[model samples]
Target: MRPPKPTVAIISPALRKANNGNWQTAHRWSRFLRAGYDVTLASEWAGPTAGDLAPACLIALHARRSADAVARFADACPKRPLIVVLTGTDLYRDIRSDPAAQRSLELATYLVVLQDEGPFELSTAHRGKCRVIYQSAIACHSHAVDSEYFDVVLVGHMRPEKDPLTAMRSLALLPDDSRIRMTHVGGALDDEYLRAVQALQAQTWPLGERYSWLANLPHAETRRRIAGAKALVISSVMEGGANVIVEAITSGVPVLASRIPGNIGMLGRDYEGYFPPGDAAQLAELLQRASQDIGFLTRLRQQCAQRAPLFAPARERAEVIKLVADALRPT
Candidate 1:
């Protein structure tokens, strides 16, 4: 007979929307953990009383959103493991101002930072409690249609923080004969972004050229397009460990990411595809060179390939299990 399953509570800020990174990670991690454990996904704690909420382990996402649950676990059962997963804002912003977030980090039995360099921002005292786990990716098989003119695709929600407009602006700066079309795929988050996308699409720029903008493609269809594209551009102002980046690399497509800590941690500091954040001119120049210069494109592809190994499903699972084992070990 099978042994009893270890019941675990998985919490995240986004439960209904499958587009967010935290939600996908929570769902995927739960599926993997289900072999040895019974996992239930919850947006927040639903205990009748403070003392009623209990589980063998609690895995919480976001430093601020999950802070209260972390504290409750600390008060109710200090011995049980409380794993807190930090997001982009939590690692780079929230911890600086939110007292609850700070307390959550301090009270966690073990902390899971999605990218490699996440622990450096923590105090030396709290550093030892952290572990790095790159989110896993599932490679998809798609028709990588040959192309004489390289295609560039950008996949991200049209939010202010994502700076999706910069991609089009940069593409506009390219010379007339660059032979590249930058396609922007994302849902507009607000009126401002929608207007900006509309205006950019109609503008006579990028050597009097324009890119096709799709409102939002289905997840699987998006992956197929990404796999066949010459490159994927990530122009985010801030990111924790982007689900898009992992998806791009897993599909063997190259990525030109912004030079931010979040992107650097996953792609490595020396990656050749970085451009200054929000700099349209620089991004355009790089895009022009990546299309005209064969060597530059090859280097970018190779760099992504090297980084791809870090995000394998088995590797992530093993890293997570090891961290759990270490945290549960008696001192």
Candidate 2:
């Protein structure tokens, strides 16, 4: 008889309704681990109950938000494996000051970061346990580009960390003859940010239609739009790793990203497509150059292609499986 498959619970603060990166990651990992283990996902893990089957391993996302669950799981089953996945806020902000976040790091048997640059953020003691698992996306055939306008699409929620207004402000700085039309796709997470985007979109442009804020679209539709655009822009002030970056690269679309650690980690430290975070003037200049200089766009595409292999589905699956297996192995 075959041995029973071990139960693994994936705790994600963001559920399916959230439609965010954490939820997407949880869902993908569940699928990847299903064949080898029995997996379940929940917003919180209250620890094993009398009638419930206990999980052999726990994978929790977002240290601060999932801290309570991590603590309970650790207390309930001290010998069982526990894995904590860190996010942008957790690494760049919370872990430094938040006690709960720090506890999660200390409790975890292993740590997972979405990009290569993630391990460097941890202290020397924690670095040995950290592993980089770059997110993956299946390749999508590029749609026919609309040559009538050089379209640049930015996909991310209108949150403070994303610094979405940078893209909006860049529209006004584009050269008078530049044909770059910017599209912003993301749901407004902040009321003030929504108003700011609305105000920007309301202004009349001397160059006719210059920007459109398309709120949020379905994931499939968003990918199609990304594949069709001339380029994708990621203007976040901070990121642990971004799913949109993987999606854009797999779709054969080049990215113009902020020169932050997360973006540099995914796009390479020397990638030519970086603009200083919040620098609207420099972003506008790059947009103009990409539209006018064929060589620039070609170079961006080549760089993106070089990084595409890192985000392949098979690679991600293998890494995820190995991480879990290592965590569950006897110490």
Candidate 3:
């Protein structure tokens, strides 16, 4: 007889085809967890009538979108462990007013936050159960300080919170002769955002004609771009924990990010490469300094290198396995 596997199911708000952050995280964790567990990925619980739907444990991503399935699994299998992973919207918005989000939290046996400071955002009653797991990526050591254009790359979908247009607008603030160029990756999520990006592409802001953009790529190629960039730019207005920031650090791509709670939490309070969120003028000034000053570029690269080990593949896998193992322990 074959040895039985510990069955684990990962639920997310999106289908595999959606290619959103939650889906991507779910997919990666499920893949990693399969080394010791029989892992399955789904959008929801098929339920009491379906024999195969119940697993030894359930791991749900997104408080609001996956709430129903989380609730159902918790109620159906009260003894089985259920872990809920919180997303960006949950931290800054939905958990504040959404009842479904609240219920999901209430039912969870354990909570996972992507970055260090996320547990503090939860209520005192739920705080003790939270764990911080910084997402990891394969390391890439390529740096881009030599490109003639002094390229600045931003990798995010065209969404409101990504504030995708801010960095491009900041380029206009650089002196007309500045060599800084910008690249905005990821597709626009809506027609309105698409039009805004199109309009900006044709205009003369931030060095006027100094930018190029690509709308998404296969995972392998995206890492290559980060490996080659002079710097990676993150313009998010809010983020729970950015996988791309981890990607950038692992790839040795120094970053210029918006100074939001999420960014500050990841990059450390004293790191110098931050601009106020939505402040195009300040972003422009930073770009100019990074371009013209050799010492500043050196410092950014050194600082990022010091932080790179935090995202190593072995480290993330260890944290994840430890979490799952602890959850399955006989208590």
Candidate 4:
């Protein structure tokens, strides 16, 4: 028999139950790495115990949330590779203020950002080790859209970072006769959001008739919804790179995204589908334009189609596997 495969440990702060981007990335990466390495997935990393072999490398998601594990691993295995994956909060917020997040960046043998714009946030010292690994989704057949309504799907939890309220508010700004419908798929994280969505849903005509909140569907179901919609709206104020964007593109659906660095990175700067973050009126204008102008909507779809190949699973899988293989190779 050949030698046993080397072990790899993946530390993800959010797991399957969270059903969020970090979890999706971790779960997908685990499946990709399993063919070459023995993989263990968990929220935290405890050092090896009696007779337990240490992982050849540790890949941790979210520099801030996984800082403790990264620190422990660094102290225990100073010579081994430790990879830290930065999330939106880590890159746009915590790395600038949080000591733990900063320390994780310094201790990491390699740093990964999910989009091209991520490295610009790093300091000169940290930038040298940073790399971009665009996330991917398998292509799903596009379902025929209902001409009665121009359905726009938004997938993200109810949180300040996601800025989901912006999308909801935009629905009210649409024209009285606008056929644009907002279908939101995410659970409210707090009572404030719960109340906000409930209030919107309870309203008459424009808001209530046009808005539908599914509140956290399964991943497959969410993808199906995205594939069936006329377009997807991503209203996040911060994102390391959204998996939903990839899902939307791969499903042959266009995206109306916020003008944020992470989003600009995934969808090129020239792409015709951006609205200012938190600007309800602007988002409303884009949504209304998309609904009424077939040529404009088709333009957005064409632009998204151009970028879809970059998020293909084959390309992502190769890049991810190469990152690991290179890290484990003897220097």
In terms of TM-score, the best-performing candidate is: 4
Q: Rate the local accuracy (lDDT) of all candidates.
A: 0.82, 0.91, 0.83, 0.94
Q: Across residues 1-331, which tens digit of lDDT does each residue of candidate 3 receive?
A: 9898999988888866666678778888887899899998989876656556578888998888889999889889998899999878887677899999999899999998887778878998888999988788888777566656787788888888899778767876788889888777788898987787777778855444687768877767777888888888998998988888888888878899898877766777788999999998999888899988989988988888887777787888898888888888888
* Model 1 quality (TM-score): 0.92
Candidate 1: segments with Cα more than 4 A from true spot:
1-3, 16-18, 48-53, 204-209
Q: What TM-score does each of the candidates earn?
A: 0.92, 0.97, 0.95, 0.99
Worst-scoring 10-residue span by lDDT in model 4: 141-150
Tens digits of lDDT, candidate 4, 153-265: 99999999999889999999998899988889999998988998999999999779989999999999999999999999999999999999999999999999999999999
Q: How many residue-pair clashes does candidate 1 contain?
A: 0
* lDDT score at residue 319, model 1, on the 0-100 scale: 80
lDDT tens digits, residues 24-106, model 1? 78888887788767788988865336554477788889989888778877777788888999877888888889999999888
Q: How high is the lDDT of residue 40 in model 3?
A: 84
In the range 260-319, model 2's lDDT, one tens digit per residue, is: 999988999989999999999999989989988999999999999999999999999999
CA lDDT of 76 in candidate 4? 86
Deviation (Å) of 202 in candidate 1: 2.4
Off by over 4 Å in 3: 143-145, 204-208
- Model 4's C-alpha root-mean-square deviation from the true structure amounts to 0.8
| Residue range with the least summed lDDT across 10 consecutive positions in model 3 | 204-213
**Cα lDDT for residue 78, model 3?**
93
